[model samples]
Target chain A: MPIPSEHQRPTRVTAKESAFTQLQQWIIDGTLQPGEKLNDIELAEALGVSRTPIRESLQLLEVQGFVKMYPGKATQVTEVDKESINDLLPPLAAMQALSTELAAPNLDENVIIELEETNNRFAKAVQKEDYFTALKIDEDFHQIIVDQAANKYIHSIVASLQTHVRRLFFHNSIILTEKSIDEHKDIIRLLTEGNGEKAASIMRENWLRAIDEFHSKKTD
Target chain B: MPIPSEHQRPTRVTAKESAFTQLQQWIIDGTLQPGEKLNDIELAEALGVSRTPIRESLQLLEVQGFVKMYPGKATQVTEVDKESINDLLPPLAAMQALSTELAAPNLDENVIIELEETNNRFAKAVQKEDYFTALKIDEDFHQIIVDQAANKYIHSIVASLQTHVRRLFFHNSIILTEKSIDEHKDIIRLLTEGNGEKAASIMRENWLRAIDEFHSKKTD
Candidate 1:
C-alpha cells in the first residue's frame, strides 16, 4: 500500500519512466516493504498518471527483478536476502574495476580535485556516523570515474548492480569505514600516477572486501 | 512486416514474454532492420496475441537498447554500431574473467570434459568455415564456466552484453578464426589445472583480442 509521497517522486522524461524510477527507488530504499502487493490503480493515481504507464512500469520492474508479476493476480516486491550479496558483488566488483581502469589514463586535474573533495566529505560523513550521507557521497566519488569510463553498457549495468548494493547497505547498516577512506586515497594516488592496472586492482579490492565484511556481520 | 514466421517464434510461459523474446530475437538478428517502424497491431496479429502484450514487450526492449519508443508516435529498432564493440568488450571481458575465476576451483571432470568436447566441435566447425555454428559452439564452451560460476547476476548481465556482442558479430560477419580455437584449448587447460589467476587472465585476453580484430576489420 506504500507508494512514494507526492513530493518525493522522480521527475523523468515520461510518465512511465518517472513511475518506474520512483518505484525502483522506493523498493531499493526500503520505503516500499518487500512482499507488499502493488496496486496499479493506486500507484497510477498517486503518480498522477493513468493505469497504462503504471502497468508498463511494472512490466519493466519485473524484468529488473525488483518485483514479481503473477498473471491475473497481484504484483509483489521481491524479498531481499543477505545472501544475494554473494551473487551481486562479484559482477559489480568486476564492472567497477573495469570502470576505474578505463578511467585512469583519462583522469585530469579537475577530476582529480573533484575526487579529493568528494572523499573529504565522505570521510567526514563516516566520522560523524551519518552513513546514509556517506554512502551517497561514496557513489558520487565513484560516479566521477564511471563517467570518465564513458562506456554506456558499463554505465547502465553498474548503475543497476549498485541499486542492489545500496539496498544491502540500507538493510545491513552500511559496511563502510575509515579503512575504505584510506583505500580511496590509494585509488586516487594510483589514478594520478596513471598506473591503471594497480588502480583497478585496488578498486576491485575496494568492493571485494565488502563481501568479507558481510560474512563477518552475518556470523555475529 | 519482417516479423519472424510463426514457426520461428520463441515459446514462453506467458504471451507477453513470448512476444518479448521473439521480438528481441527478430531485432537482434536483423530480421527487423534498424530504423524500421514497428506496428503493435501487426505484431500482435503476427505473434497471435493482443496489442497490450506487444506494447509491453516493446517497453522492455526499449530499456534493453534494442528499440526506441515515442509516445503517440512509432517505435523503431535501434541501429547496430560496430563501434559498440569498444563499449561492450571491456566490461564483458571483466565479467567473463571473474566468472572463470569463480569457476576454476569448482570445475569437476565432467565440466572439463564438456569444455573439451565443446572446444573440439568448435574447432571442427571453424575448420569447415561454418562460422555460425562455430560462434554458437563458442557460446556453449564459455557457458560451461558461466554455469559453474553459479552467480545469477553475472549470468544475467553477461547474457545481456553477449546479446549485443552477438548482434555485432552477426553484422560484422563473425570476426573469429583458428587462433581463437587454440586459445580455447589453452583456456580449457588452465581451467582444468585450477590456476584461477592465469585462467582469468586468459579469459580476459580471449575476449580482448576481438577488439583488435574489430579494429582491423574496420580498417579493411
Candidate 2:
C-alpha cells in the first residue's frame, strides 16, 4: 500500500484552521464587532459548514485572546482595549524594524520595483480616501519585507499582533498622512542604499508616530 | 435555582489546560524527548486522570508546535531545530529587555531585594553544578521583571518563547558563566540607578550572549 499525501487526508482539520483564520480576519476587519456574541450555529450557517469546525475555531480564538468563552454560556469577540494597544505596539514596531533590517541585504532590483509598485498603490488608495484599500496595501508593503526576513518566530509574533492593530485601524478611521508616505519612501531609499540600521530606525519611528497619532485622536 | 460558582463547575477544562502545561514542561525539561511518541493512555495513567484530558491536551500541544499530530495515528514531540532557536532568540531578548525597561522605575527596594536573593540562589545553583536548579532560578529572576512590567502582551510573548529556550537549555548542557552573573549584577545596578535604557540594553546583551554561545557550541 502506498502512503497517502497530505492533500488526500480528511479536510476536517484544515476546515477548522481555515475557519479560525477567517473568523480572525472578520474580527480584525470589524465584520465582527468587539464584545459581539459569536454563535457557533450562526457562524456555521454563514460559513456553510457544520458547527463543529466553528466550535473548534472559537476555542483556538479564545486561546489567542481574540474571543472570550464563558463555558456553557456564550463566546464573544474580545474588546480591543486601549492598554493592550499601548502594550502591544512597541513590540510590533520592534519586530517590523528587525524584519526590515534582516530583509535589507536580500533586496534586489526586482523586489525593490515590486515594493515601489505596492507603495504607489498605497499612496493612491490614501489619496482616494479609501481607508480599507490603503490599509490592505500598507500591509502588503510591510509583508514583503517580513517575508524576506525569513524568520518564522518574528513572522508569527507580528501576525498575531497585527490582528489587534488592524482592529485599531477599524475602530479609528485614521487618515493616511503624507508623513507616512514620505517615511515609506525614506525606508525604501535607505534599503536601496544598504543602510539597514537607518532603515530599521525609521521604520520603528514610523510605527511610533502612527501610535502617537492614534492616542492623540482618542483623547480628542 | 442559584448559579454555581466557578470552582463548583466541572473541572474538565482546567484539567486539560493543566495537563497541557505539564506535558509542555516535560518536553522542555527533556523528560519527553523529541520525536517520542505521546500515548494518551500512558500519559493519563501517569497524570492520574482519565484519557480525555490527555487527549485534549495533546490537541492543544499540537497547535502550539510542541507536538505534531497525525490524524488517526500518532502524536510526537517536536525537535528543537537550531534555525528555530536563531529565529526566536532575538525576539525573546527584545521582549525581556522591554520588560526590564518597563519594570525598572517600578522596582521598589523590596522587589530589588527579592531579585538579589534570587540571583544569589542562581549563582549558588551554578556553583554547585545543578543545571536544572540554576535554570529554574534564572527563570524566576527574569520572571519577576516580566510580571512587574504589567504588559500582558509582552509577558505572554516571552512566556511562549521561553518554553523553546528552556528546551534548548535541556538539549545543551550550557554552563552558566561568571560573565553571566556579572551581567545580572550590572543590570541590577542599572535598574537601581534608574537607567532603564542601559538596563534593557544589558539584558538584551545577556540573552544574545547565550545565543552566541549556543551557536558556537553547535559549530564545534
Candidate 3:
C-alpha cells in the first residue's frame, strides 16, 4: 500500500476544534454563565459556523465536565462546584509533579532561559493584578515543561483540569499572586539545579496551596 | 415556570451509554483487538442495537482514548502505548492515594472487615492465576474507598484510567498479582490502624512498582 500524503492526513484543527476552543473560552471566562442554556442555533449564528460543529463542541465540553447535556433537553454550563475543585486538585498536582520529573532530565539551558523569561512575564502580570494574563503566562511556563516531557496523556489531563483551576484563580488571584510568583521562582531554581524530585514535590505543594486557598475563601 | 417532573429527568444509561459500556468491555478484554476496524453496521447487528447508538458509542470511546475515529473512514481500537501508561499511572496513583486518605476518617469496622474479605479474595484469585478475577477484586478493593470519599471528579478520573490499567494488568498478571496482593495487605493493615498517610504513601508506591515492572518487561 502507498503511504498517505501529508495533505491526506487529518488536520489538527477543524471547524469542530475551533468551536470547542471558542465555547470553552466562553465557559472558562464566565461569558457563558453556569446554568445558562446553550442554544445551538444561536451559538452557530454567533460563531458564524454551522450547527453541527457547535453540537460537536457541546458534546466534547460535556465529556470535560464543563457542560451538562440532557437528552431531548437543553445543554447548560456546569457549575464550578467546590467539590469539583477538590476532586480535580490531587490528579492535577500529580500530573504536574510527574511532568516536572519527566522534563527535568531533558531540560536544556535554552529551555531554562525560556522558562525564566516566562516566569518574569508571569511575575509582571501578577504584579499588575492581571490575573488572566498571569494565568496564561503561568500555563505557558508549565506547558513548556510538560511538552518537553513528551507525555501526551499528562498533557491532555492537565489541559482539561487547568480550565477549572483558571476559574478558581480568577477569584483568588490577588492572594495567590505573590505566593505563586515565589513558588514559580522556587521551581525554576530547583529545575536549574537539576533537582527533579524536589521540583516535583514543590510543584505538588504549589497546587495544594491553591486548594487550601480555595477552601479558606469558600469558608469565608 | 413549572419544574420538570421526575420522569422528565434524563435517564443515566441510554442506548448510547449501553453500547459504550459493551463496546468498551470488548475493547478492554482484547476481543476487539487494537487496530481492528469498528464497523458500525456489524457492531449494531452484533449488539442487537441500531447504527446510531454504535456511532455515538464510538465517539465516546474516542474521547476516552479507547478508539480513534476518522471522518468518513474506519474507527479503530487504540493500541495501549507505554507512553500512555506512563502518563496515566501517576494520576491514577494520586487519586487512589487521595481516596484512601479521605476514606480513612470514615472507615468503620464493617468497612475494614469488607476490605479484608476483598483482599482475601484478591489473594486467592492471584494464587489460582485468575488475573481477570483478581483485577476485578482489586478494583473493588480500591473502589469502596473512592466511593466513600464521595468526590465525583476523582471517582470519574479513576474509573476512566482504570480501564487502561486493567488492560495492562491482563498482560502482566503473574508478575503483578503476587506483588499486588502484598501491597493490598499492607494498605489494609495501615487502614486498620488508621494510618492514612502511610497507607496513601504505600498506595502510590504500589502503582509505581507496576510501572517499573511494565518498563522492565518492555526492555526485556
Candidate 4:
C-alpha cells in the first residue's frame, strides 16, 4: 500500500486515544470496579481494537494510579487504599487555597456578581436534587478562580488533582450542597470585600471539610 | 495454533511500555523541545514499535501536560506560558512546605543524619565537577524529606511536579553547590532544634529562591 500523502488528513479521533477515553470513563463511572482484573483479550474485544491499543490504555491507567499491573498477573483496577485516598486532601486544599488567593485580586465587580449567580444556581441545583448540575456548577465556580489566575500549567495540574478528588465526591454520602453553597457564598462575599486571606482560608477549609466527610465514610 | 493460557507468565517486558519510557525520557531530558512536533509514524519507526504504542504514549503524555494534541494540528511537546507556570507554584510550594513540616516532627534521628550525609556527598560531587552525581545526591536529600512525610500520594504528585522543575534546573547555570549546602545545613539545624515551622519556612524560601533563579535565567 502506498503511504498516505503528507497533506492527507488523518481521522480526528485515533483508536488508541478512543480506547483510553472509554477505559477512563468506565473506571470513573464505576462500570469497572476496583480490583477487577482486566483481561487484555476481553478489553480489546470490548473496545473493538487490537491488543496493542488495549495494552496501551492499561499503561496510561497504571500511571494515573487507577490500575495496577503485576509482572506475571493480570492488570486490575486499583483499590483506593485509605492512606492513598486521604493523601489527596492536602494537595487539593493547597490548590484550592492557591486558586482563591490568585483570583481574589483579579476579581472585579462584574466577576463577583457572576460568581454569586453561579453559587445561587448551585444552591438551586442541590435543592432540586440535581447532583449532576450541582457538580458542574461547583466545578465551574472553581474553574473561574483558576481561569482568572491565568496560569495554564498550574490550572492543568490542579485539574488533574481535581479528577482524583471527583471519585471521592461520587462516593461521599454527605449532602454538601447546603454547606458548600453557603461556604461558596461566603467565599464570594470575602472576594467582593477584598479579603483574600479569609477567602483562601475558607476555600482551603472547604476542601478539607469534604475530605473529612469522605474519610468518615471510608472508615465506617 | 494453541492459544497461550490466560495465566501464562508475562516474563518479557512489553514493547509499549518501553516506547513510553523512551518518550518520557526525551521530554524530561529536553531532547524533545517544547512545541516540537511528535509524529507518530516517524516516532514509531524510529523506536522500532508500531504506531499503536506511540499513540498510546502520546495520550498519557497529553494527560500529564507534557504534550498537547490538536485534532487537525500535530501533537507536540507543550510550552506552558509563564502566567500558568506562576499559578502552579503556590500549591507545589504548599505541598512541599507541608511535607517539610510533617517530616520535621516525624523524622528519625538516623534518617536526618543520612540526609545530612547525602548533602555532604552532593557538596563533594559538586567540588569534583560531577554534576550528575551531585544531582542524584540533591534528589536523594529531597526524597528523604518526602519519605519522612509518610504521605505517598503527596509524594507521587510532587514527584510529577519535579519532572517539569528538573528541566528548569537543567537549564539553570547556577552551580547551586555552595548555597545549596548552606541551605541544607540550615534546614538540618532547624529540624534538629525541633523547629518545624522554621524548617518548613526555610524550605519554602529555598524553593521560592530557586524559582526566582529560574525566572531570571528564562528572561536572560
Candidate 5:
C-alpha cells in the first residue's frame, strides 16, 4: 500500500522503478555477470537517473543475493554458490510436493488441458533446441501446478527459489536442458493422466536431477 | 574490490554497514513494526548517520522484503506475508537438510558434546523462562550442525533464512521456545549417541513443527 510519490510526471519514463526493473532484468538476463562492480554515479549516468534510485535498486539487488555490498565499497553482482544450489533442492521439492498435493484435488479437465498445452509448447521448444523458449514454457507449465495449489505464500517463495535454480542450470552443462525437457514430458503426461502422486514424485526428482547436474558442473 | 571514496574524517562508524545492520535489527527487534513508515531523513537522524548510508541500508532492507520504498514517498517497513514465508522455506529446508546430511559423517564426538552444552544451556534458559537466552542457545546449537557440514555457502543461506524464521516465530508464539528446547535436547541426545539418521530426521521435522506453530498463531 506504500505507493511511490513520484508519479504523474508526464514523461514516458519513471526513473526509479525503471531503474529497479532494469537492474533486476540485468540480473535475470545475466547481463551484469556475478561479482561485477556496480558503481553508483556511473550507473546513475548510464541509467539517466540520479544516484538515489540507482543506489536503491542496488540495495534491493543485494538483498536477493544478486549483489553484495560492504562498508566503503561499491556493490557487486554475485553468483549463487554451487553448494547453495545443491542445498536449494529439498525445500523446493517439499514445496512442489505441497503444490502438487493441493493441485491434485483442485485440477479439473480444463486445467489439465491447459497445462498439457504449455507442456507441449515446452516440448516443441526443446526439440527445436530453443532452450530459452523451452525454459519459459517449462516455467509456465510448472507455474500452473503451483498456482493451482492456491497458496500464494508458497508460490512466491517457489518463484524466487526457482529463479536461482534456473539460473544455475542455465549456466551449467547442456545435458541438464535435455534431461529437464525429457523430465517435463513425463511430468506433463502424468499430470494429464491425473497421476498426482507420480507427477509430484517426478517433479521432486526433476529438481534433484537438476541439483546433481549443478554439482557435476561445479566440480568440472 | 570497488571501495568507495571517503569524506573528511571517516566517522567512528562505518556509516553504510551501521545503517544496514541497524535497519535489519530494527525489523528483527520489532522496533519498526510491520507497515511502519520509514522516513530516510528521520531514520538517518535517529541512527546518527547521514542520508547516504541510510539510503544504502534502506535499499538493502528493501531487497530482503523488510522494507518497501516508494520513489517520492517515505519507505515503509513491510508486513509479513505468509505466502512469502512459504516461498522462503524450500531454500531454507533444502539447505538445512543438506547440511544435516553432510554433517552425518563429520559430526565428531567433541562437536556433539558442544552441541549438548548448547542444548543444556537452552534447557537452563528455559527453566529460568528466559526466552531470549533460549533463542540464542538454540541458534548456537543449530549453527554447530551447519558448521560441521563444511558447506559455508549453504550455511549462509540457511543462516539468512533463519532470521526471517526467527522473526515470525518470536513474535507469534512462545511455543517455538518451548518446543525448540525440548527438541534440541532430543536432537543432541541422538547426535551424542550417533543416531545421525534419527537426529537429522528430527532436525527436519523441527522446522516443519516450527512452521506449523507459526501458522497456528498467525491464524489465531
Candidate 6:
C-alpha cells in the first residue's frame, strides 16, 4: 500500500475524481507497481478522503484497464503486457498519422512555434541521454499536433493509447534515438508546407518504430 | 426511470456488467431518452439487482460519455450533439480505412466470400427499403474488416465510436442510399484483388459520405 508523497487533495473536483486521478497516475508512473494489492480503507486514509470515494475510484480504475478487481478479493494494478505494444502501436500510429494530416493544413504559426520549442527540448534531453525527459517531451511534441487536430474522439483515443505506451516505456528501457529528432523536424516542415500525406506517413512510421525498438530490446 | 421490459436478469456476468450493458443499450436506442433522469434504486429493482451495481453502471456510463452526473442533483443521459457528427466521423473513417488496408492483403477466399455475401444482403435490404436491417447489415460488413485487422486497441476504439454513430443515426433520419451499396461492392472487389491502397481509400470515402448525407439532411 504505497501512498503518493504529494497526497494533498486538489480543490473543486469531487473526492472521487481526485482519488481516481491520483491513483491512476501512481499506477502509470510505477509508484504503485504491477500486481500491487490495493486496500480501499488504507487508500482512503492516505488520500484524506472517506472509504466511499476510494471504493468508487477503484471501480473507475478497473474499467479503464488500470486495475483488476476480483470478487470478494484483492484489487491489483494490471501488469505491463510488453507484447501489447505490437497490437497497440499500429492503431495509435494510424490515429497519430491522421492527426498530423488534419493538423498540417490548419497549423497556426504560433502552434508551429510551440512544436518547434518542444522538439528542441526533446533533442536536448536525448543528447543528454535523459530518455525520461525526452519521452515526456516527445509526448509534448505530439500533443501539440493532436490538440491542433481538434477532433475530440481522436484526441481522447490518442491520450489513452499514449498512456499505455508510456507505462510500458516506464517499465522498460526506451530506445529513442537521434533518428526521431530528425523525423520531428521533417514532420514540422511538412506541416509548414502543408504536405499532409507525406507528413502523415512519416508520423505513422514514427510510432510504429517503437514496436520495432521493443522487439530489438527483447532480443537483446 | 424506464425499466426495460426485456430485463430478465442475465446469468454469468457480474451484476455491474449486466447493468452497464443494458443501460448503455437503452440509452443508445432511445429507450432511455436524452436528459432523462436516472434513479439507481429504481434501476436496481428493474434489473433485479442491488443498488450498488446500478450505481457502478452509472459511473461507467458517465466515463463512456453516455451520461452526465451532477453532484447532489441528477445523473441524466447525455443529449446527442448533432454538431458532433462533424468531429466524430473523420477519426472513425481513418480507423476503418486502416482496418481495410490491413485486412486486404491477408483476406483469404472464404473471408472474401463472406464479405460478398454480406454485401448482397446489404443490397437486398436497401432494395426493400428496410433501412433498419440495412444499417445493421452495414455494421456487420465493416465489423468483419475490423475483426480481420486483429488489433485489439483499434477494435475497442472502433466499437465505441460506432456505437455513438449508431446512436446518432437512430435518432436522426439516416439517409444511407444505394451509393453506399455500390461502394461496398467496390470495396469487396478491390479487397479481393488485394489492392489495399484503393480499397482503403474507398472505405474512407464510404464512411465520410455519411457526414455529407448528414449535412444534406440538416439543410433539407
User: What lDDT does the true structure give each of the candidates?
Assistant: 0.88, 0.83, 0.81, 0.77, 0.72, 0.88
Per-residue CA lDDT of candidate 3, range A3-118, in tens? Answer: 66767676456677799999988987778887899899999999999987787788788988889988776789988665566777877887888899989899899998998899
**What's model 4's TM-score?**
0.83
lDDT of 6 by residue, A1-220 (tens): 7887865634357888899989988998899999899998899999999988888899988766789888676799998888888888888998899999888878889998999999999999999999989999999999999998988889889988888888888887667889999999999998899899999999998999988888888743
- As for TM-score, the candidate ahead, 1 or 5, is 1
Which residue pairs overlap in candidate 6's backbone?
none
Stretches of candidate 6 exceeding 4 Å from the true structure: A1-11, A31-51, A69-76, B1-11, B37-50, B72-74
Q: Can you write out model 4's per-residue Cα lDDT over A57-86, one digit (the tens) per residue?
A: 788778777788885677999875544456
Where model 4 places Cα greater than 4 Å from the true spot, the runs are A1-11, A15-18, A47-53, A82-84, A127-133, A172-174, A215-220, B1-13, B71-73, B80-88, B125-133, B172-177, B217-220
The residue ranges of model 3 lying beyond 4 angstroms of the native Cα positions read A1-13, A39-52, A170-175, A215-220, B1-12, B41-51, B71-74, B82-84, B170-175, B215-220
* Model 4 residue A71 distance off true place after TM-score fit, in angstroms: 4.7
Q: Which candidate is the best by TM-score?
A: 1
Model 2 stretches with alpha carbons more than 4 Å out: A1-13, A37-51, A70-74, B1-13, B36-55, B69-75, B218-220
lDDT tens digits, residues A1-220, model 1?
7865787534338887788889988988888898999998998988899999899988888878889888777799999888899889889888888999999878899999999999999999999999899989999988889999999999999888888889888777656788989999999999999999899899989988989888887632
Please report, as a value between 0 and 1, the fraction of native contacts recovered by candidate 4: 0.54
Q: In candidate 3, what are the lDDT values of residues B1-220, reduced to their tens digit?
A: 6866766655566777788889998988778988899898999999899987787678778888889988766789988665566777877887888888888888889988898899899899889987678878888998988887787767777888888887656544425548888888898899889999999999989877877777777642
Q: Count the backbone clashes (under 3 Å) in each candidate.
A: 0, 0, 0, 2, 4, 0
Which is the winner by TM-score between candidate 2 and candidate 4?
2
Q: Write the per-residue lDDT of candidate 5 for residues B109-160, one digit (tens) a residue.
A: 8887887788888888888987777777777888888998876445656676
Model 3: docking quality category: acceptable
In candidate 4, how many Å is residue B13 off?
A: 4.1
lDDT of 2 by residue, A81-144 (tens): 7656678788888889989988999999998998899999999998988988998888888999
How does candidate 5 fare on TM-score?
A: 0.77
Better of 4 and 6 by TM-score: 6
DockQ for all candidate structures vs. native: 0.52, 0.45, 0.45, 0.39, 0.25, 0.51
